[model samples]
Target: MAKKQTKDQALANNRRASFNYLIGETYEAGIQLTGTEIKSVRLGQITIGDAYVTIRNGQAYLNNANISPYKQGNQFNSDPLRRRKLLLHKREIAALDEAVMQGGKTIVPLRVYLVKGFAKILIAIGTGKKNYDKRQTIKERDMQRELGKNLKNYH
Candidate 1:
């Protein structure tokens, strides 16, 4: 018998947010999604390019994360742009709430994936980076790539 690979069902991801922000803290929270929504996520039908995390009334929410409706599911499909609630413990929410109070700091979802059959999101407590900081990051990335290329060629 052949063993099957265990692959996660990724719902969404915000790639560039990390590049533009300095990450301070991270929290993993479960997402409340419907049945068809879960199916769509398993099919990788989602986008988080412009998504953000928001806290209101002591609860965290995923805003602007587009989860495409399941093709075969009708009348049971969830809205693609609907705000989804994130399930986190009270302590985590309070900590995030305090961190968000800092200037220019906010909660941002970095990744959304499935674990143990449940949709989990990795949210970051982050502060925005300045223009000079972005430039420096670009320079550092270029330098690292060049170094790797040179080492490979030399070997």
Candidate 2:
């Protein structure tokens, strides 16, 4: 039997999001991009490290996600740091807005990928970790690394 292939192709990842926040529910969102932006994205010239999601006037926008200008797109390139609309359902946007209004919850983009030739981003609800929580996370990571090494040596 032949194995099925996954159509989603990852373009960019926000590795720090996991380390900096306690992630909760996740959502898949579509990004509204211009011609040059899509071209840049196809070439993997995108960064979401400093990107975040915000809802305003019943709409969700992706802010601070940087997409480098296409080399051949002179006079047609959009601003790299301009906020882009996130194509989500009204109910989803309302839910996210509600979640964000509570305590320290926030919406953060985790990764950008392509699905069926269309760009998609994975976003999640997260709470900012305290300094002590960050330290604990680091310690746990170190312990896991050490344990993996010990297991390898034992085997």
Q: Which candidate is the best by TM-score?
A: 2
Off by over 4 Å in 2: 1-8
State in Å the error of residue 11, model 1.
4.9
> Per-residue lDDT for 62 in model 1?
91
Query: Tens digits of per-residue lDDT for model 1 on 1-155?
Result: 63222334356768898788998889999889999998887777878887888889999999999999899999999789999999999989989988888668988888778776677888898899999999999999999999999999998
**Could you tell me the lDDT of residue 145 within candidate 2?**
100
> Each model's TM-score, in the order given?
0.92, 0.93
The reply for model 1, stretches above 4 Å from the true place, is 1-11
For model 1, the run of ten residues with the poorest summed lDDT: 2-11
Error at 116, model 1, angstroms: 1.1
lDDT of each: 0.85, 0.93
Candidate 2, residue 138: Cα displacement in angstroms equals 0.4
- Candidate with top lDDT is 2
- For residues 1-155, could you state the per-residue lDDT of candidate 2 as single tens digits? 63322335578999999999999999999999999999898888999999999999999999999999999999999999999999999999989999999979999999998876678999999999999999999999999999999999998
